[model samples]
Target: MSDPQHSNGWRRFWHRGTWWKALLLVVGYWLVYQLIGLGTSALFHDVIDVADPLSSPASIFFGVALPILLSGLLLIVLAASLGWARGLFRRESLPGRRWMWLAVLLVLIPIVLRLIGTRWSAYAVATVLAILALGLCVGFAEELLTRGFVVNILRSGGYGERAVLVLSASYFAIMHAGNALQGQPLSTVLGTVVYTFGFGALMYLSLRVTGRLVWAILLHAATDPTTILATGGIDAHNAATAGTSGLIGVAGIFSFVYVAFALVAIFLVTNRTKVAPVAPATSD
Candidate 1:
């Protein structure tokens, strides 16, 4: 019979390696995102740089939209190029009916939030629509990279389901560290990371239960920009916060509330149904 200690040691070995692997993935992707930013800056050099973050429509549009779009496509391309391409980008990989429900949830959640004690000005309405579209645009890329590619990479390398879920979630959080550049407090940034990690877990569970990336992606995309739109268009911090709000200010309150709602949704969906775990591979 196999020694129990030996089996435990082997499991620990993979677990430790998986954490390190996740660290590397986070670091590597940060570099890739930075490069994309630099490239986009060079490519879109002609856009006027408004003096104020809140006033600059171009900056707001670019900030909210570009990262969402690039992160998704970059991961898909990187996955395909690196030989880990698993048809994640294809429509067939998504759960149809479940995803449709999720899409409705995604769209409705924001609309409902906007209607609740929310003031609607002409510019705010326009901003809401623009922000919603921006969220959807980038949602695909973020989910592809964080939930889709990262999980698959970990699984193929002999990690367990729990390990893959945690690692990928952590990776998602770290990648958003750049939010600090926008004047986000360390606490808010850290909270955002943790909250997003939970989101990542929910996405992973959804994918396993449904065997489709669509619902998870749609759910992931909706909560964020929707909350932002409901509150108001991107704030100074969002447009690149210039160090105004402290640890628990207006933006912080808004962010905390948003994250809380996301957690509630996760609790609801997960408790309502059991997610099937992806089977461990015979060979990797």
Candidate 2:
């Protein structure tokens, strides 16, 4: 059982990644996801409520779950085609530290805050289950796309650790700007962009510190449902209005910390220890 990334199959044709390909894939993923959402919404519009997608099972299923799941399936297919399906799961893609525990803790704290604020008793079990399924899909899909593939691609392209950190997180965060096209208010859209940028860095840290992509996926998965359920809406538009109490008041604190961590981490991300992996050569 050798590393499949080095296999003679896909590697022969795939060659290697460039920085532009990373951007292209990110844009392509956004397009596919948005198209899927549009397609599903049109197909299920009569059955699914157009209002409050987070709280409604049918809406969440037809809108968020089905669209993202389909898009995620496409990503998986692409990963397999690129010979990355198996290699993407391997650990220690970047260096780690004990201090990174703070990074992990900051990331986890918001989930706790949101959990306390969730009125779990208010929603039907089906709705709650739908939200969970949505989270799982989101976690796997987003993490696999950004941290899994993009990070590897950046490294393979000979980018330094800092550039990889910045680009991957930026690609993950900036894609949220699409909310504006979806008709979100300027304030809400800006807020989401800011929040997701920080969230993206924290997710990157989650991958780095744990040296495993799974932790990033799980944290992202946990964060989405909790935020959705607690806020009674997605993407913090309702964050200010939805949910109350002590810890929830402390919400968005992690965003500041994550951004700060990213800022400071840039200076520290100078470790050039990883040997950039090239496309495996074939014998003539």
Lowest lDDT 10-residue stretch of candidate 1: 272-281
Name the lDDT value of residue 74 in candidate 2: 95
Report how far off residue 219 is in candidate 2 (Å).
0.5
Clash pairs of candidate 2? Answer: none
Q: lDDT tens string, model 1, 246-273?
A: 3214334443444454455443432211
- Whole-model lDDT values for every prediction: 0.54, 0.77
Expressed as tens digits, the lDDT of each residue in 43-152 for candidate 2 is: 99876777767657888888789988998899878866665666787776456767777778987888988888777777789998999999999999989888887887
Candidate 2: stretches off by over 4 Å: 1-15, 236-241, 276-284
User: What local lDDT score does residue 101 receive in model 2, on the 0 to 100 scale?
Assistant: 72
Name the weakest run of 10 consecutive residues (lDDT summed) in model 2: 275-284
